[model samples]
Target: MTPADLGRPRTPSAAREQITTDSRTERFRARIKMLGSLSCQLSRASDLDELFRAVYSELAGVLELNAFVLGQYDEANQVVHVVRQVHSGTELPGGSFPVGNGLTSEVIRTRQARLIRQWSIDGPRWQVGYATEAEGFAQPESGVTVPVVSDQRVVGVLSVQSYRAHAYDEDDLLLLEATAEQVSGALRNLRRSERLDSQLQRRVTELETILASMADALLIVDASGRIVSLNRAAREVLCIDDSAILFGKPLSHVQWREWPPAARAVADALEPIIEALGRGEALREVEAELRADGRRVLSFSCAPIHDEAGAPFGGVIVFRDTTGKREMELIKNEVLWMASHDLRTPVTAIKGYTQLLERRLTKGQATPELVANFVGVLRGQSDYLVGLLNLLLDYSRLEAGRFELEPKRIDLVALVNDVVASVQAMSEGYRVTLQTPPVIEGDWDAVRLEQVLHNLLTNAAKYSPAHGLIDVRIEADEQSATVRVADQGVGLAKSELGQVFKRFYRVEGTRRLEGTGLGLYICQRIITASGGRIWAESSGPGHGSEFCFTVPRYSRQIEQRCPRGACCWPSPACWEQVSPRLRSRRAQA
Candidate 1:
């Protein structure tokens, strides 16, 4: 009575307790293994779609399921794509659905799992958004829909359905909810990777665009001396064509040197770049200047580029075309030299001569012939100095846009004769010839035009040798009259023709010539202001030159209306009859 009665109820209760403890332990271990398996599967997924499919296939072993579909929400488009679906019994709809209408939508909206057992075909909840014809589903079904939530927000939904009602209970819902969390994390991570990749691609495109649009040359070379990147400006400066690129080509390769035309200067410019690559370390900036053409000057710089750790990776070259700036600098230097030498020499000479004459006269050592000869010498030096000063002053006035013209009508042919007569009277040992019609005329500044002719005659006479014949030709058309002054003198180089009008520009090796460089420049300015264009024609040095300029013909109406005896050119209306009667006076005396 003692053993049987005492152990009966206690023994049965203990057995049940141990059984419950074993069941809980087994379920816990199984849940842990399932989670580990799911994690392993998701880790191998490269993209979101692959993750979706992985979760779809992996969750089947962990849960009681008949039909499954994983839906991802596109909140932007308000649509959901059924990324993965697996079923053999009840047929579901195709691959997309509107977000706010289905059982899956309810879970996303609430961030909760749904256990809908009574799937009445005509029920209000099921009938409203049902795709019966498209889904081909037999009703009276049961299912559980769990939202895949991340950071407390639903990103998508995972669903499983069964053909019988009351197919799932609270424990099944618990397992599905726990599995939904892992799925959400995997999908989130995949999405983040995709967004990062997209941003990287966008940045790469922007960099390429920026490099292509740059105006200055930029070149990037690798540590191996191979060209990696070159901008549009680099290609243009190097004269590389569009049919090919410099990429992956070594800088020292013989063909690459020729690629840039290496024309004596470009070759020198690339030398530093080649050396920088060979050094394999950061290099100081090396500069190069190139004068390929007479007009444009190119400047280049090469330097080694280093990474954040101060380790040298490769090198870069930057090129700037500074033609205008170099030309301006050359002009400035020339002006400075002229001022220091030409201007100072004449002033100093005049001062010295004056001092010497004053000293001799004070000592009473001067004779009458000596006084006259000294006076002539003094006068000549004074004139020369004054001419130099006048050139500088006139050039500055013209540059500052202050030179003015006083207009009057005059016979240009008469002005030429006057210039030739005056120049010949002043300078000897040079013969002058005139070939012109007597009647050609224009509305011009008579004094200034005469001065212009005199300057040209004087310039020709100064450059010519003894007994050299200076030919002056005058021609006219309806719109303008032209004069040509030809000389037997040292001709200008072809390059000098365009530059002769620039202030302080002189031919190479001609600094020995006695004169300021402003003569031709002033002549051009005067001619341009008088409504004309002027230029010089020369084959080359030692051949000879012809200086020519044209002045526009005066309107007949304006000339005819002018008051007589005041100032006016002989209007065509007045000259038409007389021009035919006057014979050409060609003189070579």
Candidate 2:
């Protein structure tokens, strides 16, 4: 053979086979290059829509396309979610379908590739769902469906179909399978990223909710002392409406002079804590006071935040207003002092008088007049001691939730008049006037009502100037009765009005006066337990004060006593008069 003939196959059949082999090799190389390019495109895709477009474009280059479908398999529900569907180069609406008797379902069920060469014979065995049938077009004759698997599990399916018979060969099937394998990895990564993003967003929302709801002021700072975040309470404590002015600013560089006086004082107090944070030190329960707005006390804690490796990354601080607590402490101390002194004075007087009487009797200087005078003095001291002791005992019982009321029908107007007369007899300079409807009866504890009136009148007498006026008035409505006791006394300040009802709380101006500070508190407790409300009102100091309370005219206990079909009165209007027993007793008198 010649040199040129040596390069060629010897027989005609061999030469033709060689040519076919060369063509196959070139097609294989082109498919490999296409797969590499597709992988690169998928990696660069920013979203699912972009990834779907890339996949469709790459697959179209190598396959006869009449319809293309991409779906994610939901194994738990035994269904596929079609993410993208195209028919005749036109996009179609995508939806989900059950894993029924269909070619796509078979591929997903077997986790393998399916090749249908001719629709008339093979399509009937594995029928297509309504999702696959395109209206106004001939039925598909051939198709290829492959499972997109990852981690030994099928996650999705990729499919292509053609209207012509024998359209796809074994080579096309292999190419589609390889493409599905690459897509499996990319799809897995995308879903994983989406799950992580959803979890992170949920965590951030929960954190924001907690911070907003906190009552204590919270502040977070980075390692460089730059402010990272502060809660609503922190902004309120700093006395700033907008917190944007403080974000990303170093704590030490804040303009204290530009802040309000109260905020400036708070900032000054934080300086030492800031320095400690810089030194990586933790501080707890550090208290400071600001006198700029009356008096405000703050208790704060600071700690260094650390990473998982125990390296310091930043710091956090939480503070709360403690002015009420500090005031309570002061009030407690003052109450203790007053209790001790008041108890001792009565005891000392009794002791001294007893000693004096014993000495006089031993010296044979006792006379009836002298003994009588001494007895009177001793009796007065003993009564005073008994009253103080009772006050303390009542307070303790109320605090322990043991104080109870005995309710009965009573004339409120008569009770008030009696209390006024008794107080007037004891008080030399005060004149009390009553303006109330005659015989307005209510269901209340008579003894407790008397006690309330006695305490209020005595308080007015104690705090009033000589000849001060004490006015008592009563009014009634369908549901309740209101009583108001007003006195021209050393009235309470606006701030003290709310505080006066607290146990062991006395107005600062009234500290020098004689009291255990429990009378008003006990009054409030009694009124509240009777299904009522009590409050004090005053127009600042030295302007007179009024204490008003309301009680239900007919309490539950009273209703239980006078049930339906067995009552003394026909209607609630009958409560405007005294009870029959009282009326009869008055008539006899």
Candidate 3:
């Protein structure tokens, strides 16, 4: 129990314990400083490969290592490229190295640090480049490799070798791991930035393709009012062949330079609209007329387009040629006005004469027979003038798109009978007859339907030779009713049938017959507006012609209740009773 035995098994004193703790703390502090320095260097590098190179070179100096190799991962190629190499006081050729084999693969797969104290002890397991292996043996084959990982996924591996066995202690391993983590984070950031740049490029290409495909001229201007882009249509419209005209040119300069006055006005007014659009305002549209070279008249419209944040980016203008349409409108207005004036003069004259005769008769200043004869002539002329005015009004209403029809159930037989009676009074030398079915009920506008039948009958009377027959017929079944008007006049020539229904169209060969040339056109318009179609057929000139139209039929009971009574158009085959031989032949056919 002397002092030696009582000294607690000869353990070191507090001074020695304090020294050991201080050494360990110093080691930890050094490792931390190394990590911070390497991280700073790697972070400053711009891309993944550059970061890997910086991290490898900086760590080699901080650790005082002899030789090192950095293999940066290429995810697409599934290979690692030797991004950096350092051999203290030595030279080693640098190149890409495979990751599928040896020490690098083991570290990446396990995400762990590996150390070889001596190459002789485990040289067979350390397969690297022949140049690297040769350099390793010169340094006693002592080395350490640490996996660079981010988010628990190993991205690359960092390897450093020393010239002495067990040259790297546990503190060195800890420092290498910290540095690898920093390098991994920098690499991930670099990759993300690259992907964003690629996406932005693709979006720009897509926008260009869309603008090029647009049919209207497109021009894009920057906030500074300079032209940034223009589409193919713009180039053609501006008559500029080179793309140099668009880029960096002020929008106002290009818009006004050598442009027409109307185009200039449109461009000037559109600038503010584009500015408003940049403020996220609603797009503005403006129309202007442009006539540059007299080749055509153009109607132009400009509209503002906006950016993603709702700022006005630029404007789009469209041009449409309207020269022909405007000219046609002017011609139509003049012709109708003149025709109306011509009609008024005749009407005034007839009214004055008729009123004079009526006054004389009222005063008993004329004989009964003489008064009767004069009155008859006056009435006929007045009626003729009234008919002309009615025709003109109908044409105007139809052309103006304002006509409204009131349709009701009509008797096809009664309609034809009324039309024939009117035609007979107008032309005593012309014989008119109606051959029809028992009865037919159809939906029709009474006034318009009557006009159609009257026009057909009047035309037949005027064109037929003296005592010639004009046949009218009504044919019907459950679905439809057809009215046929056949004239034993000079039939329409083959070339005339197609043009008969056109406005102001008349057969020149039939000039002997007087007409306004609007009769057939009016007839066609009336029949079509009443939910029916009309057409004419002729065998040849002088062989006679037939006009037919079909209307949807109502039941016979409806005809009985109709206020206008039963009216009908005889069916063509109804003539069988009038012509036994023709009926027999038609039956045989």
Best-matching candidate per lDDT: 2
Assess the local accuracy of residue 37 in candidate 3 as a C-alpha lDDT between 0 and 100.
Answer: 76
Clash count in backbone of candidate 2: 0
After superposition on all CA atoms, what RMSD does each candidate show versus the true structure?
11.3, 8.6, 14.8
Write model 3 residue lDDT over 349-394, tens digit each, in one string.
6777678777887898778777787778778777777877787787
Candidate number of the best TM-score: 2
Candidate 2 residue-wise lDDT, 1-589, digit = tens: 4799787757888778878999999988989989999999988776677777888898888779988899999989998999888887877767999898788888888887988899887764765533344354366789999999988988899999988899999999999999998888889778887888889988999998999999999989887778889889988888867735787887568775467888877777877776677778899999998898888999989999888998777898889999999987886677677679899988998999899999999999989899999998888889889989888888767645456565678999999999999889878888888899877887888988788889988988888899999999999977788999899888888888889998777776887887887888888877766667788998878978898888877666444543321112223223323255543543453
- Give the C-alpha lDDT of model 3: 0.68
**Comparing 1 and 2 by lDDT, which wins?**
2
Each candidate: how many clashes? 1, 0, 19
Candidate 1 vs candidate 2, TM-score winner: 2
**Clashing pairs in model 1, backbone N/Cα/C closer than 3 A:** 409-569
**CA lDDT scores, all candidates in order:** 0.71, 0.81, 0.68
Error of 3 at 569 (Å): 35
